[model samples]
Target chain A: MDYAARNFAAEGYHTTSVTSIVNGLGVGKGVFYWYFASKDELLGEILGDALRSMREAQRDAIAGEPDPARRIDQGIRASLHWLSENRHLFVLMEFARTEERFAPIIRRGDDQMVADALPHVSAGITAGLLRGEDPVFLTMAILGVSGHLARTLVLEQGNDADRVAESVIAFCRQGYLATGTPALARRSA
Target chain B: MDYAARNFAAEGYHTTSVTSIVNGLGVGKGVFYWYFASKDELLGEILGDALRSMREAQRDAIAGEPDPARRIDQGIRASLHWLSENRHLFVLMEFARTEERFAPIIRRGDDQMVADALPHVSAGITAGLLRGEDPVFLTMAILGVSGHLARTLVLEQGNDADRVAESVIAFCRQGYLATGTPALARRSA
Candidate 1:
């Protein structure tokens, strides 16, 4: 899966062939099919595994947090950290989004993210810790920021993930939380 | 170049072939060779054209606007409009980003966006129209929101482009402005 993700991230899915996968693995074509039914199926698994791992990480990060705000923070950090580590996968998904074929697969991952995040965000709203907003739309906005910032900061600038994680958490919380006095955290360079 | 962009956007860059372009045009390989050397060369032209078109839109939107906030608003609308019309191109670039081999090509377009916008953002800062911030970082954040929001509104949810564009402009401007003010614009629905 890593091999496929890496290749797909690098050469693009349509450009990468099963032959190349086998050649890179120093294995026969039969060995490839023995594990997976088809190249498309294999990629589906890869994309699945990549996103699942990310979702799992976020869930694990927030498993012990008592504070809703802090839990949101941990979730953002966990997501950004995972993306930084699996940048090749990030690149793969980015490429996949541009075509008719791979877009549906990518959307599945997106829908999964909204489904997974709704409970936490809704909880925040119920707790009176967050603003009354559509949990799904808020989730989408946060996801948008997290993914884009992940690419811009970690992938593009090669910056420290921990610090950028702080910013992500801050912006996300601010974006979703209800304004008591509603103050934007001033960013320091 | 339009043929290549449309093909790359629709079928994906790697899946698109010289034969397909020629066949669609009812021309022979010799006719194709008469214009471009290879698929890669053709993509280079397409990406360049895409960037140029977008840059022009941004430039035109901001030309007569005096307020930087309003200018960004217009710029966001321009971006959304372009993406809506050229959804295929966005998809193509998204696919390209996933592949390492194709990413360099896409990155060029990404970089062009930041480079082009930096001056305007810097000007905003100097004019005290925008929050005092690092132009590059601010540029990325602006881009991060714009690109993701565009994908959601124009590509994914199929929302009205004008409405989404306004939301994008508001979200980004509020995020970037020197405001400790609450985000009055949080989505309720």
Candidate 2:
């Protein structure tokens, strides 16, 4: 699976054949077919596993952090750290999102990701740490903020995940917990 | 080009062929070949034109809005409005982001988009209408927020663009212009 992932990241899914993947590993086609049904199925497994591992990392990172806002910060940091380590999965998932057959899979993965964050966001709203807003929208917004920062800072710019996480944590803390005073009001004060 | 865009959106770029596109349009191969050197080139043109139109829409929407916060609001609404109108183009652009050949083109379009939002964000910071922060990261965050909302609300949920735009405008107003109080500080206050 790791072999196939690396190839897909480097060569793209359409261009990477099962034969090529096996050839790169100096193995027989039977070895590949024995474990996987086809290239599409294999790619699906990779994408699914990638999402699961990311969720696991975030869950583990935030475990025992009682403060909802702090848990969210830990989640964002773990997500970025995981993405930095599994950068190849990022390319594979991006490709998965484009194809018709893969769209449902990627969408499911995204839905699950949003689900994982939903509870923390809900807790924050309940505890009044975050603004009393719709947790669903806030969860989605939090994921968007983290995903964008991960892509630009860690993947594209090769910045340290911890550093990028700090910036994301700050932005999202402000975004989710801001007092209702308008900028005009604050400026005048 | 319109025909190609529709086909690409529906069938995806990888599944789409020059022959199929020409056949759909009831045109000759020579007509397509004369305008575009290859299918990749044709798709690039379609993608480029779509981006330009969206930018043009945004520019037109925010043309006379003098306030920076209002300008960002106009930009988000304009973007969501354009995305709602050009749903097919959105699919195509998502596909474009996956391909090696198209990644640079999409990146350039994205950079141009960030560039468009940067000036207004900077203006907001300068005018004390927004919290002073890294404009580049803030601009990307704003785009991320708007894009995710548009995808979930307008495209997936069949909500009206204006309705989603209202939600996005409110979220971003607080995101960009929040008072400089940490969540911990607010919680204690």
Candidate 3:
């Protein structure tokens, strides 16, 4: 699975053939067929495993954290760190999003991510720690910020994932306004 | 261009052949080749034009707005409105990002977008109206929130573009913290 995923991420999914994968590994077609039905199924499994692993990282990061806002922060940090380590999988995920046959897997993973984070968002709002915006939108906003920044900064720009995570948390928690500024003060009023 | 873009968005880009596009439009092969040299060139042009048009909309929306922060808000609203209207092109844009040959076009367009917004973000930070974090990261955070939200909410979930824009701006401005909350107050302190 790792070999196939690296191939898919380096070469386009459609361009990477099963023949090449088996050939590269010096394995017979029988060995490949014994494990997976087809290339499509293999790619699906790759995506599912990647998403599940990412969620696990996030869950582990936030475990035993009592503060809702801090939980969200730990989740963002965990996500960025995982994404940085699994940059190849991240690229594959984006590529999968573009294909129709693969979009369902991506969508399901995204929905699962939102479901996982929704409770903390709700908790924050309930405790008056977060704004009274729709919890789903707020959750989506956090996902958007973390995913996009990880792609642009960590993966593409070679920036440190931990630092980018810090920037993301700061932006998510306090937004653009500086501390005690008139604009922020007025908005708070 | 419009016909081809619609087809590319509906059918997968690779599946939509030049012949099918010409046949659907009731145009001869000569007429198609007269404008574009190849199918790849046609899709490239489509993606380029869509990005250019979107930027123009943002520019027009923010024209004569003196306040940098308000200008950023207008820019986000303009982007959502444009993406909602030209959703087909947006899908095509996402697809274009996946292919190796087409990734440069998307990257260039994204860079142009960041460049356009960087000045305003810098101005806001300089004026103490925005956070003193790296201006580039702040600009990317805004883009990330607006783009991701628009894709999930407006494009997929069928939410109103304007309403989504409001949510985006509110989040970008004040983040996830509620007004006068102890979390926010403590952060400021």
How are the candidates ranked when ordered by DockQ, highest leading?
3, 2, 1
Please write out the lDDT profile of model 2 over residues A1-189, one tens digit for every residue: 998998898777887888899999999999988998888889999999998898899889999989888788888888989999998998788778777888888789888988888888888877767766677877777777777778777887788988777777767766422255453322111
The most accurate candidate by TM-score is: 3
lDDT digits (tens) for residues B1-189 of candidate 1: 777678777776767788888898888999777888877777766766777888898889789877555566677788888888888777766765665656687788788888877877777777666656456666666677778877875678898788776655545544322234333332212
Off by over 4 Å in 1: A126-134, A173-189, B126-133, B175-189
How large is the i-RMS for each model, in angstroms? 6.4, 4.1, 2.1
lDDT of each: 0.72, 0.80, 0.89
Please give the C-alpha DockQ score of model 3.
0.63
User: What interface-residue Cα RMSD does candidate 1 give after superposition?
Assistant: 6.4
* Model 3, global lDDT: 0.89
Predicted model with the maximum lDDT:
3
The runs of at least 3 residues in candidate 3 whose Cα sits more than 4 Å from the true structure, single-residue gaps closed, are: A182-189, B29-31, B182-189
TM-score of each: 0.85, 0.91, 0.93
Candidate 2 per-residue C-alpha lDDT over B64-182 given as tens digits, one digit per residue, 9 for 90 to 100 = 88988778888988999999999889888877776778878888988899999899999988877676868887787788778877777688779899877876666666642224435
Tell me the lDDT of model 2 at A92.
Answer: 82
User: Could you tell me how far off, in angstroms, the CA of residue A119 lies in candidate 1 after the best superposition?
Assistant: 3.1
Q: Which tens-of-lDDT digit does each residue in A23-142 have in candidate 3?
A: 999999889989999888999999999999999999999999898998999899999999999998998988777667888899899999999999999999999889887999999999
